[model samples]
Target: MFNFLKKKELHEDGTFDESGVDAGDFVDQKPLDEKESEIYTDLSIHPEWHLPEEEVYVYRFLNQELPPLQPNQVSVYGVEIKEKDGGLIVDAFVRNSLSKGIQMKPAAIIILDKQGETVARQPFDLSAVGTIPGKSSRPWTFLFPPSSIRDSEKEIPAQGWRLALELKKKPTKHSLDLSDHWKESLPQEEAQRLHQLVDSMKPPKAGEVNFFGLDARQADNGDLHVTLLIRNGSEQGLTLRQLPLRFEDRSEEVVAEGGFKLKSLTVNMNTSKPWTFIFPAESLKKTGFGFVEMEGLSSTEVMEI
Candidate 1:
């Protein structure tokens, strides 16, 4: 495999100097259209191989300029939705606008409601869709059977709902540090996502970090496992040695309170990190509850050590 990573020289001023680097080093060595299909074909067992010949042609298309995909850039854009055979058929465009010819692995095709809530989800062996060339937007029909439908019995409204691709893998990369200007090196979609995530959240006061609740669940032992998002919108990174947390319930009552030791965990400016903290059974004041108030945290005192 060719390394798509670009190596550059970082200077004391945080600017990169590519004086000796050739511009052609970044260009793809082989044209995507010229790539042999042998490398793109997956010989392993796949459910799509059993599909009818006519149905198989729905997603199969030829791409001459198959370019490499930037991480997490593949997405589908829906053009039409119709009811057929007591199921839903989505005519959509599988877009790989970032880079190179690529084939997708098997992944779930998700349908979202008007409110962006998942109404249906079904897995598909996307490799059968064939080699999708880079800078390409190909049309394909995805059939979601009745069994996969979770929405109401009423017919799914075609005009309102949206198409979405589930994150097949957990994201390991986070936003860059305040001083790092290298986020430009990231895929355009990824950089935009991180930027929007930070901007969408009403930032905390200047020079301060906000700890908000993302999710919370009570285990069988009544241990409240809470997932918190540490959002840093400051100009520099900050270290967390300790944080006192109060878990509140739907009634605005504190169900659990604890001081979590973070051991100098650093949160870079303009970045967010999620950490799950388990409030021991003994520490919880309530026995049975769900949906802890994550928004109420805004008014809670933030203690940083």
Candidate 2:
């Protein structure tokens, strides 16, 4: 048995893949190691990512002494904007948190005011920024031509301005390992939203199953009505073989013990299901016990089953 209901950052950097697209827009985001092989695109450094001019810009920027970064954050800071030759020039430092080098490919440079209103938003081809080595900071410049100025009514913000990135959205990655039957009923956007929601959930450690007792109460006949949650955080699904549960009350005293045979019950990977267990009066321990201190069942342990 494991923690029942228990168990419990992608930053602005526009992620890149061999396809030269930003992976940031995808709903299902996972660490490099956990994704399915075919669907996963390694967004790390590529030899061809840096053009001759782009390489020079990154080299010069990283050479400058920079400040420390929080453990895992891709920060775009040190924004300084200027209007030159009837065009806007944005200068800022792009910081990378990954140990692997990243060559930013494409994204929008959005300027916002003090109240968080968009002053100017322009998409720029960031190939010029080139490859930003991991664990380093690089300065890149973007020039929004005069044409971009007319696109928005707000004038260029000088004093209380903030610079941000609007990474382009990529097409849906249906290659994800979700069941086709489940996706059939879901609209495209809704399906993508669910994928994002599920993917954002923090799964139990690899090969660990958490059993949580959501709620429990004593029936009039002294039987125990227990609502339990079974969580399977592993990459593979399994049908519960058996459950040997021992429920303890608020006083930490055993209140019930019953072995439940889950009839062909199945839990998919990275998902959980709820079930109600009724412990007959005979199976319950001494009464007068308060709330329960739910315990684990070895059979439900992610490692064993």
Candidate 3:
């Protein structure tokens, strides 16, 4: 039984390969010389033996930035309006002709009277529509409630009513790898460790964001539910990934801490959008946690303000 575990094999250079080596073989084997030892040591540090998962991820976000919104990037096409249920329903198609992806907000339609005076300004929200990929088009619909089209002293013009559409520019795409096991591909906790390390560095300046109209309450499932409005007040759109959120009580102690993400998208310029953040069950330890404030973080560098 012991003899079966041993083998006598050697390379032409008189070195024993591990595949056929036994404990007793090492007694007569020659030790590797200085030159051969250095060669083997250098091969151990080859990149193929290690993964650059964290460095790849860190450099990805560090270099990923949204391009500026160019003129005529997004345009409204094939719009048709009809009256239904005492309201006006708009059937419209939007096309993104650029080579970059875009997320569209609601387009505005300005109704003008026969004399070119403004009659009613209606917002045609398009949140239900899917994202328009680069050099692609998508369809969306909007309805103007009857009450929204009424004027104090006049009805909608029968023949001279004109509609002007305003298509707001959307933010360009910023790529991030979302592959499965992306957060776990690295070894020795390097992924999380490097993420925190790079996140602490100075961030590049982009668009400005502000929060307002906060509403927080407890849901039926015992989770804390929050809804707030955010506005991008900068001249250009921004790719926003996370928002810093906290709940505090009258004593100024923290109760629950969390952040929000845009989930592979960005906000439009000068656009106000609503976001909802939910804290899981039993997250709040204090019943007096009544005050809440929210802040935004830069997507490219994870810097929070």
Best by TM-score: 2
Q: Model 2, residue 63: displacement in angstroms?
A: 9.4
Q: Model 2 reaches what TM-score against the true structure?
A: 0.35
The candidates, ranked best first by lDDT, are 1, 2, 3
Give candidate 3 regions above 4 Å deviation: 1-71, 113-116, 150-305
The predicted structure with the larger TM-score, 2 or 3, is 2
Per-residue CA lDDT of model 2 for 1-305, tens digit only, reads 11112211112233321111223332122224322222211122334545576555444443332334443345454346777877777665666544555555566767666777766668866656666665555555667777766444456665566566665443232222334554575488955754564355455665567765656887788888886656676657768778788776655688788789977777776565556689998877686667543433233334544
Please give, for residues 1-305, the per-residue lDDT of candidate 3 as tens digits: 00111211112333321111111211222322222220110001112324366534432332121112222244443234556777766443344434444555655666666687766667755444555554444444566777667473566554444445543344433212222444455464744543443344332234545554345677778788765445455546556676677755446577677776757445455454445679886777666444444323322222223
**Candidate 1, residues 233-301: lDDT per residue as tens digits?**
566677888878887777878889989897677777557765678999888787656665463355344
CA lDDT, candidate 1, residue 97? 38
Clashes of 2: 7
lDDT of 3 at 223: 86
Clashing pairs in 2: 1-297, 2-210, 2-211, 3-210, 3-211, 4-211, 4-212
TM-score, per-candidate, Cα-based:
0.34, 0.35, 0.28
Each candidate: what lDDT?
0.57, 0.55, 0.45
- Candidate ranking under TM-score, highest first, comes to 2, 1, 3
